[model samples]
Target: MSTSLAEHVDALYSAVERAGPDAFQAALEGIVEATQRSEPAEVSAALERLEPMLARIPLGMGPDLAQVAGAMTDFGGDPASVLATLVERAAGAMEQAARFAELHRAAGLALPDPGDFDAVGETRDRFTAAVQVRGLAGEEEAEDLLQAWYCGDSWVQPVLFMNQRRDVRRALPQRARLLNGVRATREYLGTAGWLEGLLLVLDDEPLIVLDRGFAGTGRGFRVTIGGIGDNFQLHTMLAAALIGHHLPGRAPAPAEVAAATDGPDLTPEGGIRGSWNLVDHGGKWIWNEGRPSDIPHLDGVRVVVLEPEPYQRSWNAGRAYPHMAPLLRIDEPLSPQEAAAWLSRCTTSS
Candidate 1:
């Protein structure tokens, strides 16, 4: 017989051992009655007891139980009903285990030293060294480094870096996508609600990085950030966006605003004309590289935007400025009026 069959038998025997003969017999009877009458509740109750029993057995037993479960459910309740349901559930668990096992096997995986993830001490030292080599300093320095790395000529290096670091690569992408999704949702809702509890971001690119943070309730926002990235510059920007501001709360940056507003006018051939190049919408022009076909289009593509509430507040504090003179510029946050003016300029330029 197949190994699966043996596993099923073993699981059933184990269940019998744990529940005793009397409970097992009663469960079997319940399965039979439920199968015969097509009563879901009876079957569910029977399965509940049976499931715990099966959990004690090795994963290999799953396929056998799954088969039995499927057969019993199909057989419609009888003495065979319990066996059938068990088979079905077992099959599912076995399949999942098989997949997980295969993934680990393919990579020849092994555990890393605990020191690799030491965030407060050695990890910080490593980060400091990296930043120093890049000649960047201070808190905002990290963000600047990341932006330069991603948007600069050496962007490919970071991508490769993430790909090579197995531990960090596995988790970074997941975390990034999750953060983006949550930000988008909050922006759509138009509320300053907090994302309470622990949220983790994982990416599978080159570096397997994990980012953890907490969102605040009420008007205050609290966030803690940490992660490994292929490029310090790209990761810094990502961290800022993830922790500094909630999505949709902030206006686009000057360059992004320019692109969004002006994009509709620029044609593929260069000058604005009636027949715009559909390709231009999808193309990207790297600094001096001209237009590249590989770059995807953003025209009409929906994206989430995040703004700093504190920045907005600062801008508003300067509301008393005389309208006649050029609005007194401040380094702090922009108020609603200042934000509007900035947006208006972007719109007009576009």
Candidate 2:
């Protein structure tokens, strides 16, 4: 709705006299530009203009258009209708699947299911009754919390984005165990709607995008765990951190993460245990008594180990790891010294 965006869109509209490869390229560029400027409304406007031309677009450009639409959805644009048009225009199953994936993720932007809202009531009851629950500020604070729940359920979510040299499917044992642990934790958490993902080449950079819905309340807790060396290590640490943030929980101290790494994996069927297998290393707690030191999920829930070789190749080829756009970002790349320090932290024993 901004005047500048209006002007820009007008320019693009004027330039696209007919539907052709050049027109598709121009529209794609417009969407990308609007997205880069963080103008969601403009992105929507640009896509609206392009949607009518979907039928006329060359079959070869279907994938290209779908790719930009996917990126637009990530950046807050509503491209559902446009994506639907592209999906129908797709020439094959692979093309349809690609377009559908973007459509599915965009669907996540809608309000969460009514059942999901039930958690807010539980949170309210517990929060109201606890006289000394952590961060309790009485009735006003409770109201704020309720309002947050009311605003929407499909808000910010956690995702692990990686660019590496190895396929995620063919992970090293350590990374495999960590991946399994994460999937098991999600299964145990009963978050059925969580997404299982595949490797993708996005924006000319290979990426592994794994994401799912996480409650807003669960995210405000500070991440006390540190000492990360690789994507695998970071993912495992986040699992431990999230577990600690849940009820009857507290964030794992840095020392605990340090201790947990290189430790035995958390295997259920009498398999090898390693860092993925979380233990209470007895670190100090910022909130409650902290996560129980006992091993968890021994029943052995089914887990999906995401092997990320596509991204691994990109990383090994000297490409920087892709940022988790619009949600998480690295303002700058790690320098040699900084990278070495992380490696040192990972290598050093507790």
Candidate 3:
């Protein structure tokens, strides 16, 4: 804990009585002054021990504080200044809440940026060149209709500051905990536990928040497109990008969103049958891999799709799809002998 940002946090504790925007600045200066006076041997020894220990554990993230300190310390830079910037950015994230001080004093100090990349430029290039976004609803479909469009996929996980009240997500206990690399934290803590534990775990790094909700802008809210499903902004454009369809450049207005065309609508029977259909409609819609496809449910057997890359499937699909879900359910019905027999027969001969 001492190797982490505990000292800078103590400065924040000391400086809060001082008041205002300058308080953060003062706390920053206080940290620099304090660290500069500490015995250089103590700091160097701590960093040397921390380096190899971090290597063994593998947070699987870009860099931990010890790594940062090593680079800065070895390369002639200041650890105090580096920590001040991290605290400042984190403070900006928690600025809105009444609980800011308590949270800041606790977990707010260790969060890191999820790492930045040039998203807009990447979106433009990837979408424009994708051959995957072509037409596929029989020959009657116009070949030139979608000849030039973006068919890229997007996986957005919005990270909110721990200060905000996530009451909406908290109230419901049913959303899926879609576990992938991006959502690993949410999965490890479990979504409900994350909501409950937010205030308690402030010092933990990689300060982004994830939910069972969606990839969108502004606390995950945006203009509603009737066909695009819930959570507008990013999902709208991303859904458009994924299937490569209408209003693909940006999301339309709340009024315009309703009128804008989306992907293919289901027949009286549920499910989409073509590439063009997949692009226009939204929600956790699964891509039908070439040809009209439906996996039949067999007695005593259940099928589940786990963690698709672009994440068009809902984590909450335990409720099932409209028509087919009624027939299929999840369970472990086979006894150990039964399971072994099935596995042996399936693998050994045929």
Number of clashes found in candidate 3: 8
Q: Output the better candidate (2/3) by TM-score.
A: 2
Per-residue lDDT of 212-263 in model 2, one digit per residue for the tens? 1122121122222222223333333444544443322333444334333533
lDDT, ranked from best to worst: 2, 1, 3
How many collisions per candidate?
51, 20, 8
Q: How much is 278 displaced in model 1, in angstroms?
A: 13
Candidate 1 per-residue C-alpha lDDT over 26-61 given as tens digits, one digit per residue, 9 for 90 to 100:
544444434545455544444445555444533322
Best-fitting candidate, measured by TM-score?
Answer: 2
- Tell me the spans in candidate 1 whose CA falls farther than 4 Å from its real position: 1-36, 66-350
Give candidate 2 regions above 4 Å deviation: 1-27, 86-235, 242-350
Error of 3 at 102 (Å): 32
* Best candidate (score: lDDT): 2
Summarize candidate 3's per-residue lDDT along 1-350 as a digit string, tens digits. Answer: 24333365455444444554466455545444444545665445433433333333212221223234433343333333333332222222222111222222243232211222334344333322332243212221211111111100011111112112233123322123221211333322222222222222111111111111122111211111111111221222333332223122222233222211221222213221111122211122334321112212223221111122342322211111111101111122334454334333221111
Q: What is the C-alpha RMSD of each candidate to the true structure, in Å?
A: 23.9, 21.4, 25.1
Which of candidates 1 and 2 reaches a greater lDDT?
2
The segments of candidate 3 whose C-alpha lies over 4 angstroms from its true place after superposition are 1-4, 26-168, 171-350
